[model samples]
Target: MASPIKVCVTGAAGQIGYSLVYMIGSGAVFGADTPVSLHLLDIPPMMPVLNGVCMEIADCALPCVREVVATDDPSVAFKDIDAAFLVGAMPRKEGMERKDLLAANVKIFKVQGQALDQHAKKSVRVLVVGNPANTNALICSQYAPSIPKENFSAMTRLDQNRAQAQIAARLSVPVSDVKNCIIWGNHSGTQFPDVRHATVAGKSVYDAVNDEAWIRGDFITLVQKRGGAVIAARKLSSAMSAAKAACDHMASWWQGTPEGSYVSMGVFSDGSYGTASGVMFSFPVTIKDGKWSIVQGLPIDDFSKGKLEVTGKELCEERDDALAVCSAAQ
Candidate 1:
């Protein structure tokens, strides 16, 4: 067997992390042939819960999991890691302003990013899953100057999956039949779930659904607000689906997306599609040999262009707020 790759997940005791750890243990993110040394991190107060999670993983006897490390220290958890799921962050409280929440998370990610820079493998792949993810990712990458900006990405695969599922349901086709449903800009409600270039079982989505009005209206809103809808129904944020999407994200990153296909990831923008540079923005990206490139040359209609502008503006504002917070700390 090949040497076990070191994988770390922060917030390993939380709902999403609970589900995510099991998936990783089962070789969902990495291939079944590859063994993984799992490093699970949570806050000191949550160590008991994290320990219990480790115990459960031991009980499962998953062949892919070679060893497990549970710790409260970011340095310990990040040491020599090959990849990480940065799932922990300060959530927005009921009365807290957006800038306040950003300030709180900026502290969290800044510390973790330093840990990654000091201890993790130079080629470590990092995925930031916490809310305000695009800006949080930008913060994390900024603090880890040793790591390539391309190695850092925020999760927008969840949004893309939601878009594909909605399209499939609308067409009454299997979800697998949906392809290339792109998520443009931030992961927030301003994201544009563009189906303009999507195909449904070898036919154009527009040709298959025959409802441009619904596609431009309800479909976009539903995918954008699906997280809130889930929270309303379950009285909890999305965990199971979020875990699955994270797995899909890492797996695609590890093993390249199939030829002629792509997925959405919030990566450092290189001014693609007129987005601001240095901000983490979601775009349709294809992975190959463990590297991702933005899909180029997709024609953007006026409506899609306007939607991109909205989300891009939101991200820029968030990035500025986060930078102000970081500057204040220094």
Candidate 2:
């Protein structure tokens, strides 16, 4: 049997954390055969809530969960961790601009990243799930100089999953039938849900539907704005779906994405597709041996290229905005 892995989750008392911890404890993130030691972290004020969460996790009595540690300190939470999920950040409030939101979260990620560098295993994989996640991940990576840049990622699988569901519903097919729904650029309204290379059960989605108008119009907008739509309807941000997407993101990273299949993930851009370096941008990626490589050489039409340009610009601007905050702090 493989040795137990340490998994740390920040914001353990929050909605998404509440939704994700059980799945992680039940071997959803890793595998049923592997044991995990969970480290739950939150702010001091939320310690009581985190303690209750730990109690519930224990009550589940999962065979795969070996130990649970609840703490309010980054040093304790990140100590020798194998996988760390950076899920806690300040949410965007009424009238707050995206730059303002980025400023608010950058400091949090910087501190956490330093803690990870100081305490976590050198091979630790980090996923940033909080809002403005791509930039938050970038900030975290900046602080963790010893950790590989490839080890840090942000959550864009939620957007990809939403895109797949929209396409599946349109074609009256099972969601599992949809493949290669790529989410490009940031995890924001500007994200491009590209279906140019997508397939539905081994057939090209373009030839299956052939509705360029709807694909360019409603399909893209729906995937990009789905988070806002969910908030509007539920009067709360998407907790369950977001948590499930995080699980999917980590699981796919650990267990290889299927052959010839890919998922969109927010990884550091290495000048791929002309995207700027050091920014965490969502691109279609395949995982093998617990590492992700960007899918290369996919055809980009004029429409998709234009959307990529817009989203790429947005991500660069966000990177700059967050970097400015870091500089100001110094």
Candidate 3:
């Protein structure tokens, strides 16, 4: 076997972490041939829970999990790690403003980002899965100046997968048939799930479904609101699907996507498509050699342009809010 790669997962005792760790150990994130050592991190209060999780993982006899280190220290957990999943963050409760939530998570990510800068491999790939994820990712990347900005991304594959499933259902075809489904902008309710460039079994989604009305109206809203729908029906946020999407996000980034297709990842923008720099915005990107390049020259009609602008403005405002919060703390 090859040398084991260290994989660190924050919030290792939480719902998504529980599902995610198992998947990683089972070779869902990395390839089955690659050996992996898991470094699981959680708050001090969750130590006992994290220990039990580690024990269960041990009991699973997963060969990929060569070694496991469960800790409350970010530096210890992140040390020399190859991939870090920033899944832990403050969850918004009843009546909390989005800005307040962003403020609360800023300190956490800032500390973790500093730890990553000091301890992790320079090439480490970090994915922020916490809520207000796009802005939170920006905060994390800001602190880790030594790490390349492209190495840090927020999860938008969940939104993309949701879009793919919805379109496939509408077209009465298997989800696997859906291709090039793009999720633009934020991961929240304002996300634009566009299937304009998508296809189902070699046919354009528009031609296959022939329902422009639903695609422009209910489909977009449904894709954006699926998270809330899950919370309402289950009394808890999505765990399994979220974990699966995180796995897909990492796997696809590590192993390149299809030749003509792309996946949505919230990465730091360099003023692409008129989005301001420094914000982690979601765009359709193709991966090659473990690096993602944004897809260019896609036709964005006036309506799509308007929606993109709305999400971009929201992200910029959130970035300002997080910066103010960080400044206040200093």
* lDDT of prediction 1: 0.91
Per-residue accuracy of model 3 over 93-201 as CA lDDT, tens digit each: 5445677778789889988988999999999999999888898899998899999999999999999999999888887889999999998888887889999999999
lDDT: worst 10-residue window of model 2: 91-100
The per-residue C-alpha lDDT of model 2 at residue 197 equals 92
- In candidate 1, which residue ranges exceed 4 Å CA deviation? 92-100
- Output the TM-score of candidate 2: 0.98
| Candidate 1 collision pairs | none
TM-score of each: 0.97, 0.98, 0.98
Give lDDT per model, in order.
0.91, 0.91, 0.91
What would the per-residue lDDT of candidate 2 be over residues 94-186, giving only the tens digit for each residue? 445677778888999999989999999999999999989999999898999999999999999999999999999999999999999999999
| Comparison by lDDT, 1 against 3, better one | 1
By summed lDDT, the worst window of 10 consecutive residues in model 1 runs over 90-99
What value does the lDDT take at residue 61 in candidate 2? 93
lDDT of 1 at 285: 97
Model 3 residue 35 lDDT score: 90
